[model samples]
Target: MYTKDKYSLRTVLLWTRRYIYIFVLISVIPVVLYQLAGWKWLHLPWRPIGLVGTALAFISGFKNNASYGRLWEARKIYGGIVNASRLFATMVNDFITNEFTENNKTDEELFLIRKTIIMRHVAWMTSLRHALRVKKPWETSGNNTSDKEHMQSIHIQEYKYTLEEELDGYLSDEEKNYVLDKTNKQTACLNLQSKNFKELKMDGLIEDFRHMEFKNIIGELFALQGKSERIKNFPYPRQFATLNSFFVWFFILLLPFGLMHEFEEIGISLIDSLSGNEIYFFIAKNFIWLTIPFSIAISWIFITMERVGDVSENPFEGMSNDVPITTISRGIEIDIREMIGDDKTEIPNPHPEYNNTQM
Candidate 1:
């Protein structure tokens, strides 16, 4: 996610400029009809429009809260993965031993076993992250033309490498091919891990209780993976999203008509306050035009609120605002590999941030 202190006014304005153009037109059109065409009947009473604005605020608040809850839950699930991965790696390095084995193995043999198992876990993480990054029909950051244009300016590591190629770094050729052939490659990787873990149990390298513990960690990892996939596959309800957009635009379109009547009356009263100076009368009467900018600014506030929630609902879409799952996955790899005695130089470097976001 974005790690900056705050999004500056310039950044917020630039990000939302497309919507601003539409808001300007929505505000100005009614003003033009009311003023230039002398369509006084088009000016609406401010009270009903004010009521709609209030309802819009309540609805937008509900949507944003629900969307943010999804994003936070996704983050927590990955947090669980990070913890469970480290625990599993430590078990690989420490739990299995010659303590119960028929033939005593050398330190080198034990170390090799630890490294292989940790690397397999790393492969599982890789496949799970790739699955999360896959675009769903409801996601906007990678799907829409305008959002795709914006994303082009930012670099995502997953986009730089193919899933098959990346899996090669952690999985054997046979294992990678087997996984690639499956519908859920991550699930396949987990099955491979469980199979290897079971073999260790059968060989007496790990005792029965220790084997059970290892399976439990794997089960936790599987649960975490499934949670993330559920969020990625099942979208926030489209009904709430569709109607939120319509209602926001509907309120904005009607906003200027109500504002114009209010501003014009204020302009006329101000003109009557002026002492008979022709220039002052002209300036005071024309002040009604200030409603255009006011209307645009207010409409922008409501629209921006709606847009924030819209984009936040899908946390794995590789958007700059999404949870930094790729970065988190890489970090876990580094940690687990280091625990298994891999050289620091052999480990890949951390993912670099793009536009203040790590993804």
Candidate 2:
């Protein structure tokens, strides 16, 4: 969702700083114990460590791949929505006509008809985006202040206003009340649309063919809606996410124990080679502390990768890395309204980008 070329280094570091602290603790504690207490027994061979790293890499790669697929598919579904919406708007604007009607309406009345249908579709978009942004129990982005701050830096700007508030301008008092009463407001809106199209048919505003085509587009919208809902309601398998973390952490905690002795051996050889050089010996003997940074670096990489997968699995969670469906919805709204020939000044602007992300 980041529309900037990438997250700033400062932003990335700040977002990962909590996990970095854990890594620092995991790396530093064992090094201190080994150095100060002469705990030579703390040393571990590298082969088993290498094996764990290799296995963890494979699983983590799979997780990331699956997560990215979820993210990309969600985006593609919304992209479909954008196209279908424009097509629907164009069809509605052109198909409904006075040609078939015995009691023909003026062009102004027809414009109002087109406006009503398109605006209801706009309301549906509003409701859908609102539904998507609802926090699930498993979602990581919640009401925490710090994470909220970072997310808003690149999050959906439309999330600020209540959907109800936005719906007021788009729906009549009766229509608004009808929609608000429903469990799935967007689905309710679509049903209203279908009913309206049927009424338009009875009134001879649209012929049978146009009515069926409208119904077909509504069906596609339903399919897109279900696809998004499936992703939102169903989660990635928990066992894989849970066990991957445990394995990565186990390997990271064990890493310094395995590598510190190897670094110490290197230090010893350095001192032997530079014999009688007091400065070099001092530097060589203290080189074991370098393992702290090394271990921290390695741990950060694995943990960050795992976290990325975790967050990516839920694209509707309103995280900075989410799919930006709200943004896409707004773009569709802007396009559909324009295509229907709504007054340019009356239409709202596209949702503003956050840190270059159009969320």
Q: What is the lDDT of candidate 1?
A: 0.85
Give the alpha carbon lDDT tens digit for every residue of 169-251 in model 2: 89989999999999999999999999999999999999999999999999999999999999998888999988998998899
The per-candidate count of clashes, in order, stands at 0, 2
- Residue 212 displacement in candidate 1 (angstroms): 0.6
Sliding window of 10 residues with minimal summed lDDT for model 2: 2-11
| TM-score of each predicted structure versus truth | 0.95, 0.95
Q: Rate the local accuracy (lDDT) of all candidates.
A: 0.85, 0.86
Best by TM-score: 2
Instruction: Give candidate 2 misplaced runs (Cα > 4 Å).
Output: 143-146, 152-159
Query: For candidate 1, lDDT tens digit of each residue in 1-359?
Result: 65465744555676688889988888788888888888889888999999999999999999999999999999999899999988888888889899988987899998888888888888888888888877778888755655675566667666778888888767788888999999998999899988988998888899999989988988898899889988998999999999999999999988998999999999889887889799888878777688899998999899888877887899887766678988898899999999888978889998787767678
The regions of model 1 sitting more than 4 angstroms off are: 276-280
235 in model 1: Cα distance from truth in Å? 1.5
RMSD of each: 1.7, 1.7
